[model samples]
Each structure stands twice: as structure tokens, then as C-alpha cells.
Target chain A: MGKNNVEQMILNIPSDLKYLGAVDAAIQDLAREFSFSPDAINDVSTALVEACSNAIEHGNHFAKDKRVVVTLRFNGGDFVATVQDEGRGFDFAKALRDEAGPDPMSERGRGILIMRAFTDDLKFKCDDKGLTVELTKLRGGGGDAGQ
Target chain B: MKITQREVGSAAILDLNGKLTGGPDADAFRDVFKSLLEQNKKHIIVNLEKVSWINSTGLGILIHNYNTVRGAGGDMVVMHASERIESILYVTKLNLLFKSFNSEDEAVRSFTAAR
Candidate 1:
């Protein structure tokens, strides 16, 4: 039998930034039910929301017909999430720290940095598939080593 | 988050709860602060007793209002901050930029006292 700790869920939304609020609520509900710390839960929620925002804006180019897929996992002691887009893959390094590094006043381009700050690990995967933001965090902070 | 506005004598009190991040309140929050400033509201007190968390965007909006309020010769006071947000303020050195109090009454009273 499974340890009852490894559970996963998937959600697909209609590629709109406005859907972020709903995503936040869903993350919160799952996190709270799993007894996650408020900070950890908020961190994941914020980072995931930013990833979806970036996907809609940069990945799919905000195309009305596009769709974004988000996969959430609660495995062992870690809470992992991924956001995938249908557009051509993106440059992870550039997104992490832009060429100009982004000004504080600018609303755009800081999503990836914010995601990195909130999560223990944030990666952009490429291998002919697409741009995927892979985010991982210990629900409490054993770094996944304890997992 | 739950936001409530009430008039206290001449100033308005905005009571906030939960987290202050994105969604419906982000723009409205900034607009409310701006509208208050436009009304020549030089004194503002934000009740943060119940706020759970805030992201950089939320912090940015607060700073946006802070600069606007300061530029107009008005001061913003915060009250009853949780340790999480207080840590962020301290780390960002925003704790020095604004005055904070332990309770709602204390924060509002300081505004009246300063006037």
C-alpha cells in the first residue's frame, strides 16, 4: 500500500491571468488540509501563480485559444508543482535574471525571480517539449533530502 | 482578504484581513490609497492585525502608496503586524520608513495625536 503521503492532482485552465485567483484558492485549500505552514503554503501559491502568469504572457503569448496545464504533487514531505505551456521553449537563465535585471517599478519580468526566491528549486526544462517551470519545496524544509 | 472602510472623525480606517496579494483587491487597494490621498488625507492608519501574508507585489503597492502619501506630506501608520510581514519589513528596511503600533486604537490615536 502507498504511504498515503504521495498524492497528485492536475488542473487545466483557459490561459487567462484572471484565473490566478482561483488557482490561489485551490492551492491554499490543499496546503491547509495537508497541515502546511502558512508561509510555505503562501510561498508555493505565489510562485505557482507567477509561473502561470508568465506562461500565459510569454509561453502562449496570451492567445485566447491556448490552455495552460498545472500539475501539483504532494509527495513524501515535499510539495512540488509544474506549469507547462504550449509555446516554444523559453530561456531559463534569462527569465531568472533578465538582461537588464528588471526595474523594481516594472510589473513584468520579475515573475521568475520571485518564484526562485519562494521555492527551493525552480528550473526551466527544455528538450524539444516546451517551457516548463519545475518548482520544488519541502513542505516544511528538509530540502527533499528527508524525502 | 477582507477589507472594511469606516470613517473615524476625519480619517478613514481600512481594516484588512487574510493575505494582500493579487486578485480583485490589488488594483482596488492601490486606487483606494490614491483616492484617499487625492482627498487630502494626510493621515492614514492601516490595521494589519489579521493579515496572513503578502508578496512582493503587495509590498510594491504599499510602497507605491507610501511614496504618494509622503510626497503629499501625509504619513501612513501600520498596526498589529504579524511576525511574517514584520520580518519582511525589517529585511527590506521598510520598518524604518513607517511607524508601527501594537494595536488598532494605538495606531489611529497616533494619527490624531500627530494632528
Candidate 2:
């Protein structure tokens, strides 16, 4: 792990959902530091963007005063992102993938499925404090991401 | 984010570029969508290749446009979506709601094809 690699930065933002771009910026900076390929960086960025949105929308329900804490860490060989929320967590097995039918008609409900598809590792942890989503994507690895 | 609109062959093609994460981008998208409705051009094709990311508000704007246009006997088609953006569209099941194309030309062609 590179010592100067940010190795960690946590930012807490209001659960307003409107401030998602702030999360996007932080992710971009962390991803770029690894010299990730344009396409690779794009994959992680897109997944993380949707993850942050779900944290605010589904987990926190856009409650303005509530907060979502995002932890970013870029080690030499791996990129890890953790989005923590104070709201209740969600069910993964019960998730739906109707967005894959093609023809581009469905208008909502697709963030988490996309996160799992793009990132190498996706997990949801729900305890008394609330929910924490940990996503891990390796740097410079072929992995299972589709182009 | 910036949404620029133009008319091509009885269709309204909105070129959406930049991040659309519900801040200024969301309102800007709404204003643009509203202007298009006022202009009476209903069949729409949105170019989202340059749009890297968006939150729920951005997706809601699409729903708003879809409802408005369909009410006017027109529908919205999406064209030239980058892969990352396409994932968002797919996960949201919007792929069924919008007709997406590999290029703007293909999307424009679909207006007549779908008919």
C-alpha cells in the first residue's frame, strides 16, 4: 500500500440526495490516483455514484438532517469504498433485475444491481448503528466487469 | 450539466452533457425539458454520451419528460449512452422505458422504425 495513497478519507454529508456530486468528486480523485484506465475508472465511478444515491434515497430516505458517511481508501493494489448510512438497510436476495430486459423502458429502481455488476466485491452490513455497504474493486486486474 | 435541444426530422433531440447529480444539473434538465414541451415537439431523443453520472433527480427528470411527451402522443428515446451511463439506465429498468441506440443516427432512425 502506498503511504501517500490517501490510504483513507472519510466525508460525511447530509442525506439530502442532492449533494451526490460531492461524493462523485471524492471518488474520482481517489480512483484517479491509482492511474486507473479510463474505462476502469469509469466503471468504479459509475457504480459508486449509484451506491451513494441509494444510501441517501433508500437507506436514509433523503432526510435532510441525517448523514451518510463515505470512506474512501486506495491502497497500492486495491480500491475500496464504504458508504455508511444511519437509515435501515435493504434486502439483496429480494433485489430485482428487470432493468436488463433492454429496449430502455424502465425508468427507475436499478442502482444496487448495477453496483454489484460493476464492482468485484459488494456487501451490505446492517447492525444497530444502521447499514454499511462495502465495495471492493482491484486495480489493474481483469476481474469480472463487462465492457 | 447542460442540455441543448434541436429539431431533426419531426423529433426533438436533447444533447445532455456533464454530471447530472440533482444539483444545478437537475433544475437545468427540468427547465430544458419544460421548454421542449412548450415548443410542442414531442418525439424526443436524448443524447447522453457525455453525461457521466446522475442521481435520482436526474432519473426523475426522464420520467417527467416521458409522461409529458406520451401525453402529447410522443415518446422519448435515448441515444449514444456511454457504458457507465448505460448501466444506470439498465439497473433502473429504464432500458424498457427508453429506446436506446448506439448512435444518434440510429436513435433518429428508430422514430420511424418504431412507428
Candidate 3:
């Protein structure tokens, strides 16, 4: 189906971990509506968490006043979700580069990698306002991730 | 995520359930691990059989705890990881960093075996 023939949902939550449950609940509902495979649903769930975590922890810097916006669209066959933050964006590319050599002892720097692994298509955008991370996965695109 | 603790011989087994995504959930996991370190209970095995999933934040928590225990002359490993969680570890290359076992008994045995 065409991207225009899509149903969209927008949710905005404060940049707080306590609000994560609301976001995840909506995701579960969307997955069921989209008839996503169990595995696909799990992947989307994990990826969504990572995106929101990065937005709150890195993009918004845990600023309670800031908000994270999540947009979900189902184009009949594919589901796309976008996470938007209200703080200045960092160089995601640079972060990916730094995380290239996984350090067993390192305690951080794997958020983006995990996001990329569970989604079929992942994109990052930044502007003066903040950053946006988009994640997409097909209904059957449930197995063999990590890019 | 909910984390419960138990002891098997000299090893500490942390039973995890639900999603290990960070936020308040992550804080709980971190607190438990920190307390274990404080108690000098370092030979740890995180049992993930009931853990439905884990994100990057969860992986970070695991790594952080692993290093902490190792630094204290102890060790940490994972057991009963779901297929999806195992895939995450492989993609992130954490599989190379931490020892993984198919069962809690196997993981517990590794610590003594290493000694």
C-alpha cells in the first residue's frame, strides 16, 4: 500500500522514565492491530524502548520539562514509528563510529546499535530544535536483524 | 523489569523477568547489582529465562555490573537468555565479553570451573 494510505497516531509524553509504560502500552496495541508476528512485535517493542530511552537520556538530557513525541503510522503492510526529542541533537554517526569496536568493559554506547539491529529501516535526523529517530519494520520482517 | 536474587553455592543468581529496558526498570536492576557488589557477592549469574526482551540500556547495565564484579575479583555471566536477547548480545558483540550458558547450573559451574 502507498504511504499516504496509512493510519497515524501521535503521542507526546514528558521526558521521564515513569512515562515509559504508556508508550510501550500503545506500541503493544499497535502491534496487535497491525497483525505483526510475535517476533516482529518483540523487535518493535525493543527498538521503541531504545529510541525513547535515547531521546530522554541523551537528546533531552532527562529534562523533566522537555517532551518526547512519538508518531506511529501503519501503511497497511509496514509500520513506522518516529521518536522526537526537544533538545539539541548529537552526531549519531560519530557515536556509531565510536561504538564500532565493542568494548566488553564499556558500560555505554550501544543504544543506536540495538536500535538498528531490531528494525528493518532506521533513520536519524537533527535540527536546531532537536533530534528525530524513525524506525520501520514489515509485518513479516521479524527474524535476522542487526546491521 | 523485576529482578530477584538467590544464592546457589557461592554464586549469586539474579532472576530477571519482563523487559530489561532502562528507565525505572534499569534503575532497579542497577540497584540490585550494586547491592550485591557491596555485599561482596560477585560470582553472579543473571538468569534471563523469563526476561522477554532487553534493549541497549539493559545491555549497558549488564556490562556495568560485570565490570564491577570483575574489578572486585569476582565474575558475572548470563544464563537462559531468550533467543531474541541472545541475538542482541551477538549483534552488540557482548557475547564475546560475557560468558553465556544454556542453564543456570552450567553458568554456576563455570565460575568454579574457572577457579
Candidate 4:
């Protein structure tokens, strides 16, 4: 693939956890197509799953009527994934701050932290439609993958 | 996730196969742990040799159960975690909290050794 050419894949699923495997499979295939290292592929797959989980559990509230849409794109140098949900969004910044405490025993709030640790860039957007989490991984970033 | 329980000496080992993500898996894991606690099996070892994937939610499940076991005056350690799972635990600094061993024998020995 040329640097100027972009490849993309979109996955739409209900707010169900069982479909997460499909999301992971799609991410693995795309990451491989981009020649991501084995560790990098795992990194992207993990981060994407976190993003999708948040969308399903938090944003969509597990409503069967709701949907989580994921977009995966690669532009030769970077792989990006956007997970969008169909519900009102929560406070991303506050959640991150609350989870930043020294307590390691807390069982409820490490999703965003893990996403940040594994991805090169993380962005969140909330509006009337829903919340969209954008995650980007730079090719060959060699950033603590599977550490 | 599929959980199989076996007792090696006094330690109850929960061998897990498949992804340990949240949802029904969390409930199933909790049920198993609760049953163990009811049986007074405090020392526990989580065997993750066959877990293909685990995310933060799965890690959270582990933390909750680990705390539960500790509160009951017992301990829970892990064995055979994949490199990917280890990475998640490391990034969360949970590697410091959970004693991990490469083999089941070592994990079972940790309980007796601690005494």
C-alpha cells in the first residue's frame, strides 16, 4: 500500500459483549495488513476492545436497541480506530482523574488507563449523537508494546 | 471463559480457558470463587495457560476476586499468564499486587511457603 492510500474497515454490532471477538478479529487482520509487529497487533487489539467495551457498557448501557460502530483505518504510517456509541456520554476526564488515585485494588475503572497506555494517541468526542473514542497507533512506534 | 477447579494439597486451582472479559464471564468467575470461599478453600491459584485474551474488565474481575480471597484470610496467585495478559497487568501496576508464577507447582508452593 502507498503512503497516500488509506484502507478502512467498519464494524457494526449491537451493545453485546459476545460480538467483541469479531471486533478483535477485524483489528488483527488490519494490523497484520499494515505489517504491525506481533506485539503492536496485540496492543491495538487490546485498546480497541477496551474502547468497544466502554461504548457498549457505558455509552449504550447495554440496550439491545443501541448499536456500537467501529471504524478501523490505516494510512501506511498509522492505524486508527474510532468506536461510536448511541447514548449519552459520561465524563471521560473525570473518570480518568478518579482512576488516577494510588489504589491498585479498585476493580471498576482501569479501562481508559489501559487504553491510554497501549495506544499512541487517544481522543474522545461527545455530542447529541453519542460518544466516539478515537484511538491511534503509529506503525513502528515501539512503544512499550506487550511490556 | 471455562473454569475448572482442582485441589492441589490445600490450594484450590481454577484453570481458566478462553477470554476472561466481563459480562457473563465475570458472573461465572464470581460464582466459582464464592463457592470456594464457602468451602473454606482460601488459598487459590488462577491458571491462565489457555486464556487467549483478557482486557481491563477481566483484570478487574481478577482484582475483585483477589481482594475477596485476601479478605477471607487467604491468598490468590496467578500462573501461566500469557505475555499479553502480563503486559496489561504490568501497565496497571497490578503485577506488583498479584504474585505470578510460570508453573502450577510454584504457585501452589507459594501458599505453603508463605506460612
Residue A125 accuracy (lDDT) in model 4: 90
lDDT of 4: 0.88
Predicted structure with the largest lDDT when compared to the true one = 4
Clashes of each: 0, 17, 0, 0
**What ranges in model 2 sit over 4 Å off?**
A1-6, A96-106, A140-145, B22-40, B55-64, B67-72, B90-97, B101-106
Q: Summarize candidate 1's per-residue lDDT along A1-113 as a digit string, tens digits.
A: 13247888898987766677777888888877777787777667767877887777678877888888899888875788998888897667766655333554333344555
Candidate 4, residues B15-107: lDDT per residue as tens digits? 999888898998999999999999999999999999988877888899999999999999999999988889888888899999999988899
lDDT of 3 by residue, B1-115 (tens): 7788999998999998777767677678778878988998889999999987676777888887777788889999999988778878887888888899997788988989998
Which residue runs does candidate 4 get wrong by more than 4 Å? A1-4, A96-102, A144-146
User: What 10-residue stretch in candidate 3 chain A is worst by lDDT?
Assistant: A138-147
Of 2 and 4, the candidate ahead on lDDT is 4
Better of 1 and 4 by DockQ: 4
Q: By DockQ thresholds, what CAPRI class is model 1? A: incorrect
By lDDT, the candidates rank as 4, 3, 2, 1
lDDT of 2 by residue, A1-147 (tens): 353455888899998755677787777776777677776787777777777878887888878878899888887658889988888786654553342422343445546666776688888888887788888887755434453
User: In terms of DockQ, which candidate is stronger, 2 or 3?
Assistant: 3
In model 1, state the lDDT of residue A56: 73
State in Å the error of residue A55, model 4: 0.9
Q: Give the TM-score of candidate 4.
A: 0.95
Better of 1 and 2 by lDDT: 2
